[model samples]
Target: GPYVIPSETPRGEKYLSRIKLSWSTMATTASCPPPSVLLPIRTTTAGARLTSSHGSRAGHAVTTTGGAAHARPPLPMGMARALLPQRAPLLRRLLMAGALAASCTCFLLVLQAQASVPPRYDGFAYGVGAAAWKDAVLVEAFLDPLCPDSRDAWHPLRLAVERYSPMVSLIVHPFPLPYHTYSYHACRALHIANKLNSSSTYPLLELFFKNQGKFSNRATSSISSTAVTGEISKMAAQAVGNSVSEFQSGFSDMRSDMAARVSFKYGCTRGVAGAPFFFVNGFLQPGGGSPIDFSTWTSILEPLVAHHGQTIEMLTSV
Candidate 1:
């Protein structure tokens, strides 16, 4: 049988979407009752009674009385009036129960969508490390070039890298914090420098961290973004041993901003809210958001190295 739409009757209305009904041959027998033709209905806002005008087939219009609009469409009500009286009562109960279950399911789906975390980082670049090493674990570090805590973490991290080369690698993500006005410029500088010389990116970061005081003061001294960019461009040229003009072209390219933005977005998905955030093996390190002591980092790395069949002394000697 064809799907039934809502029909405005004295009792109420019933609406169904894409429904298929199985009609028995007995339905046409004299003992059976007539099939109710469910037609689409529209209600009025004036609290007027439902007034329907249409046949059982499609292409028919059902209008409300008094020409008023529907405030809310109600759920499908009791079974069609033409059904056997005994069957109508049980069928209506089942329809109401199903509607309630569907409502609950929809609510759960919405909550699940809201609670989901955003996508995380999966690509390479913006770090000083081999893209992949079977023996090595990948660490992502989020840093704001002008933050003091970031500087504090840099030393231990670099020493760790030297000691754990093929066994551990760090991917630096420049997440210039909002409060550090000049930090974003510094991050952009690192991005530009990386393009000029991949090896020079970390060195450039080191330079910025060492002289954060100067950068912070300059940032607060009412200098324009262009002026700061020019200053950074010159520094980048010196760091990468490239001609100033050559460095300027790469620094000014739109890709510099693109690189910074990609890194920032990746960090956000991983829950990086501030500078000096660290993730080892894609898991956030305990107390990684704060300035961790050198010994603490060594404690964290020693077991990882040992687990990978490499001792600290062996890697340090290498």
Candidate 2:
């Protein structure tokens, strides 16, 4: 398996298309350097500037800036070539014609690995999004209702879903940590609330995040449980525009329990370790699970979206 190096660059689509057209399947037997790497790429008319080793140790990644275009550029070669499976001579010829920046080469390697096999568990993900489409990028977010970081990640992720609605699908799976004592209960409650009124999902989630302290604080724990129940009842009434008691009765229903179990199982089966795990197009986000701002997401997604369009155009032309 080739370690995926995530790249953010405008020209990725052409490179990806070229790799798909020219290269044979990359072997899974190839030695991988690390589990993941993040590369930040900036391109100018002159050439590309790549910041490598985004999430790994200092020496693991390599960056190239400014001088490649002037100097005889290195051949667009993936890192650790000895690790790659044997390829046809034609593959080498295509790579030599237009050299990719170091990071770009690594991204192509990741793409190659993806093309070689089926996804690990495509059906387990859940959330709001279009039906799965080959061309649409699948973004799976693992989040905890009680985690501050998850709350922070919500805003930027929402922006991404809105902006790239046509090109991407966002699926969120709740992963409540045990340490957050009432998190499971909250997850159950919210799931039922959302099921009762599908439109209430995001708003109720926002409400939970905004008032997290009330639910988690030691002083408020017992008192807040009852209080929060009432609060959710009020919210459910408002969301469903029905009698509060009727909505409240459904808040902790059996269906919500089943939904919570499903989400927890999905995360656990995938070996999700903590609060905020993100996967873009089935490739786990390379950088550690930190909350990325809107601009950062835009940088990562725009290239994928553009690459998708270019692929469609290329197919139409043929």
Candidate 3:
């Protein structure tokens, strides 16, 4: 079966496309040595005849009467011989061509192998020692801070991360849904907290998820965006143990807004359509938008952790 490489990013897709074009060009032009090198004629008693020992014309004969070589029907190799002075260059070209083709084939096979494996997660790590363990399963949670479903998933997801300990790493991406009026502000607040104190990120996320009702669209219907952000900054500052004034200052910093926007844009690239989305080892898990339980997460992660452990053990033994 043909291996289909999952597209991780637009840049990666462009890189793969360029490699494909190079492969195609190599296939068409370098598949065989030049005809001048492979089809040198030998003067025989019968006539001037050229014999091919490689490529499409392998084991065939060509006869020349005048100055031009003419193709003949397929015949036996009785007349084929090493009767040309260009034999050394011919072998050299054949070897060079063979080596080139083999290299391209090996490169493609390596790419196919990589395509079969799930991509490793590369994002901001959450929680203590979340990314400390080598070969840990990566669990990415894309959540809108004010989304009800995200709140519901928080507990079980936290429990799963704790249960797995160093064997699993969780990265929380703040994906603010457009419909949620204050979701973007909430996410920006979380990012501000992260910048203030790296360890405070998850705590602030938990705080937002727990008190999401206070910042819901209905609750803040009459409030201006500035008022909502001010309220969120208070909560973020308290959660991260920073001064409210300092956190509010961060809110005004364009970098915090840019960070939040980058997070949202990354979610879009990952095809996140709603809150509480997930990716296990970079493969999107369908139906992850709904809240998942601790038991369900365990069921999905146990075998994966065990397999990873076994792989490590095998590699060490070897």
RMSD of 2: 28.5
TM-score of each: 0.57, 0.55, 0.61
- Compared with the true structure, what per-residue lDDT tens digits does model 1 show for residues 1-318? 333233344332322111212222444453342222334434354332323444433333446665644333332233333333545477889999999999999999867744333254422333334655434776677888889999998888878766777677777788888888878778878877776777788788888888787678555588776777677777777788898778767656787776777777677777888879988887898775687667877888888877766454678789
Q: How far out, in Å, is residue 47 in model 1?
A: 48
- Please give, for residues 1-318, the per-residue lDDT of candidate 2 as tens digits: 232323344465465445444433332344333222223344444443444543433133233554453222232246447445777798787786656566688898766644222233322222444555445877788888778889999899888867887677787777888888777766776676666766666666777788788677574566756676676577556655667887667654776666776777777667788878888887777554578788888988999989988987999999
Q: After aligning candidate 2 to the native by TM-score, how far in Å is the CA of 223 from where it should be? A: 2.6
Per-candidate Cα lDDT values, in order, are 0.67, 0.65, 0.75
* Top candidate when judged by TM-score against the true structure: 3
RMSD to native for every prediction? 16.6, 28.5, 20.9
Clashes counted in candidate 3 amount to: 0
Off by over 4 Å in 1: 1-131, 217-219, 310-318
After TM-score superposition, the amount by which residue 91's alpha carbon in candidate 3 deviates from its true location, in angstroms, is 64
Comparing 2 and 3 by lDDT, which wins?
3
